[model samples]
Target: MSSNRITTLLVANRGEIARRIIRSARALGIRTVAVYSDPDARSPHVLDADLAVALGGTASADSYLRADKIIDAARRAGADAIHPGYGFLSENAEFAESCRRADILFVGPSPESMRSMGLKDQAKAIARRAGVPVLPDAEITGDDPTAWAAAACEVGFPLLVKATAGGGGKGMRRVDDLDTLVDAVAGARREAASSFGNATVFLERYLDKARHIEIQVFGDAHGSAVHLGERECSVQRRHQKVLEEAPSPVVGPELREKMGATAVSLVRELRYLGAGTVEYLLDDRTGEFFFLEMNTRLQVEHPVTEEVTGLDLVALQLRVAQGQALGIEQADVVPRGHAIEVRLYAEDPARGFLPTPGPLHLLEYPERPGLRYEVGVSAPGEVSAYYDPMMAKIIARADSREEAAAALASALDATRIHGLVTNRSFLAALLRDPDFLSGATCTDFLDHHQNLLDPAPATPTVVHLAAGLAASVSRRRAANPATGFAAPGFRTLAAEMLMSAVWQPVGREPIPVAYRLAAPSGDTELVLDLDGTRHRFDLIDLGADTVRVRYDGVDYPCAVATHRDGSIWINDATSQSGWVPEPRLPDRTVLAASAAGPVSEVPGTVVAVLISEGDTVAAGQKLVVLEAMKMEHPALAGADGVVQKINVSVGQYVDAQTELVTIGAEGEA
Candidate 1:
């Protein structure tokens, strides 16, 4: 490594990946330039870089994907080279060519090689020519239904209609019969047109139980290239990978060698330079493999490969792009141990992987050995809806696959993220699953064991306790007059005040939990007497309605409330307050009436008002249908009431217990 050769490098990306590349460059005493969009002007990546330049707009197309803007930023920042750290413009061959034209080195494969390998169909053709086994398929053009259907039948009934320009599962469809081939192809083409602006599609045999395996390959300008190892990326959802591990579960020394050799041969035949990945689908039952696709740039799951290989792929990319020869031979790149990386995303798996965007009030990871964390943001940072929802990458390494699984499980268990929802626990569940541990997973692993991936009992008890403790700390802070007058000023005369607090955890239920807390005066201990169980809390003053509390020797994340009514919510900790509301049963009364009046029992949006005004209705008959929280519930007639007047209409939003229609007794009906 020479100073003059690699003094300055520009990272043409943002978020965690950009920061990650900058870290590798800085480790080698290389200055790093960060490029950011308008929204990311104050982002962590921009702040961490030695120099930063604005890329103008917030959208990917206007910022990171704009080759001219990126090149100009690099030139202005005095960067000698640009590293497209995965995603955005990383796989764009034209961008690489533009960088070369500007006399700014691009830290990746040559443009011509990238162009050859970036297209899935083109890459498959190249693989076949290089003696690599490829999936049976034919590239299709034009909208002629008959020709396309004939092509589909030739590939077989159970085949894939894939968009030539598609990735990330978009524009991919599985057709099982000739009757549905036209529709599948049309839909795939439309989606491809929208997502990648390329409607031209191709056909391929779809393997039901295929395991996604990819070989990590590196090349240099000196006609030298070597394969590092393989990564298992079978754990996926909607065709996007959720969890990845190196030294694939099904691949041993023999399979690894075969796959690695094929990957090296494919790259050399294409004259590829810099780092790339050659993905394959391995049939678990038959041990047969076929070329899937080629990623012309670094992948999101590269951390897993790095963990097992102990090599910095980014550094190698920079060196190779500068005309350096491959330093190590294939025999020297033996992968040792097993490594697993779980992508902690700001999305809720329970809600169909819906993005969960909010502020990161608290972010903490364990300092345990063998666990490596790559985070892009810190506490109080926000995960907006404008970008990919990945919060962090939690990687763990161990001597064996079993050790690695256990290590990852422990790491996830120790991870705590508050304020914003994350898939931390969900990822932990996958790592701890028996099938995942035994390497008995396929593309349908999550679909097969949906219950395991999404536990529906709400937050874990430990997390609840932690949030409660944090809330308790906030209560203590508001209790003191000096801290804040938010809490009722310490009343020396009153022993305890009757009060109740409502807490809505995960924005679902409002639990009417009442607690009796003792006043604090240094000697008096704050105890939370809930449901006859006593829990002690140690509150540390942090000034102004903000206190850090330790329950069971663990600090909890908490916040304070401005008003009374017991509405203060602590994230994952137990808290104590001076409010004790006695529980009393509601008074039951029997009303004697001659006629019945119509009323809605529960309030919800009216999906359909089954009965109109003057419509006859029988007793206990269905009157209206209401939809609440995406679930439908029916409202029935009580005591043979008539639809005297329709108060609500279909598709009208109503409150709880709102009257939908008026009803009378049987005689009136």
Candidate 2:
């Protein structure tokens, strides 16, 4: 065992994971350094670190993935060790070796161990040798399309073409039939090469109904290892885990013990160290589990395990890296109540979970018991298109799974995030889903339940009234500072004239609101007319962009914020909505410029231009592929037509709503 102590550590990562590691290191009296890309220079994680170094690039390829630059930053910061926090070279065995050659402690497993398990194909072989059950798979050996088809035939239909090098749902494609097998393999290879710098892929049998269970395993240099427990991560979208909970509801004491022992056995066999997760696919039909791949680094969902086990996983990683023995054994491990975690992403669930990268005008989390937030960006901060679009991880722990699920769902509802679209409401809906609450989740949960992606319910009239009042009150207050003590909209004129304004709520038609200030008596009263109906309400300015409206003896406190584009966002007790005031005169030029074409829904770099000028295309044919937040989004033809013009080229950066290809009528010049 080595006696080297890590006094100063550099986190070779950014965002919430980096901040999380810095928090743990600071708690241990160790100073932390942070490395960031150009976009993350002013990020919360960089500000939280004792020292920060800029790598000077916007994309991960030019910045975070530069192992040489990261090591140099560590050396310049005088850091005794480097902590690769989950992505961007975290599982890179070559990077671990580089740290060793530089005499810097890598706060993870050794290079040999990483190499043994970094690739899925190799990891499955090792797990099989260790007597762990594994599914049948065949590696793509040659470029021959026929050979690829043969391998797919051997594995059978309804299989997955998965990248051997990386995890996190990247470089993975599900092919249900032979006709799409080749395209799936090609796409998976391109993605794998882009994500992990490896194009190698393999075909694995896809279980129709499977529970994605993973065991958190840890090992130390002193030949000690332990399994904290298992986490259920079956709920997914595009093969990426959306929610995770500790102590899976489906696994009882006997099953948990069996899986935990298997995980620990693999840990011992590989002599693994630090935080690692052993992923398995439990076939719901047969009640048997098969080895997937082992994540050789800390998982994004590690917080759920930490919540239930009452352990600081980052602290454990640090201690193990310092050559300290894991004092606790398998028997010492005890899991408590249920804990659930959901990844809050800056994406539009209604739009196929497309990445929505933009400024976060307002980000607020409800403060409640048993609720934890591991946030990456601050309000008013930008979610760059160059990186992952995940904004935060919200976790809740309670005595039972039911309680935990309810608490998380409620907390999500109370969260106020504005500016760009997000999957907040979708997550809340999923948590309250009957199947999810009953622990009947599988890898295809989202696929089977697409209704969750539907648009939120229409904003209630009460909410709209509250929002209109709040906005009017704010404007009135700003206009008359000297009359701060006076009632808002209190016109001295005896004639009560109605003020009219049209407000358009998102995903709904325009609403006409006519209001007039009533004669103030004991309290301020505002009279409102909606759809030829009249109502009276007592309005009170609560200050700080908040207003309280009393209707039917109930007080509703509404928080209001305005976007730069003049959109008004209001959050009331029951719901939140964004309303844009309709201009008395609409811009005809802008409306006329909007034409039918294939446009990008989010900002991204054009990776492939599949169509050219005058090219005839069918409806739903892919015309251009845009890469944003490291994921490819294909812009498809809207109807059968000839491509009138191709406006974008490969590697060109485009913004949301930017037309990539304009399709005209068939035979049109």
Q: Number of the top candidate by TM-score?
A: 2
Model 1 CA lDDT for position 659? 61
TM-scores for all predictions: 0.75, 0.91
lDDT of 2 by residue, 1-669 (tens): 144698899999989999999999999999999998988988999999999998998889889999999999998999989999998999999999999999999999999999999888999999998888999999997789999999989998789999999688899999998899888888899889888999999999999899999999999998998899999999988899899999898998898898888999999999898989999999998889999999999999999999998999999999999989988888888899999999999887887888888878889988999999999999887888899999999999999999999999889878888776788888988988898888999898888899998645434556445646555565766667676666554566665678887776643356788877654665567777889988877777634367777776877778787777666778775567666677443432243246557777778888778778888899889889888998989888878989998998988988877878877898777
lDDT of 2 at 1: 14
Q: Which residue ranges in model 1 land beyond 4 Å of their true spot?
A: 1-4, 144-148, 175-191, 456-502, 507-669
Steric clashes per prediction: 19, 0
RMSD of each: 10.0, 3.4
Name the weakest run of 10 consecutive residues (lDDT summed) in model 1: 583-592
- Worst-scoring 10-residue span by lDDT in model 2: 584-593
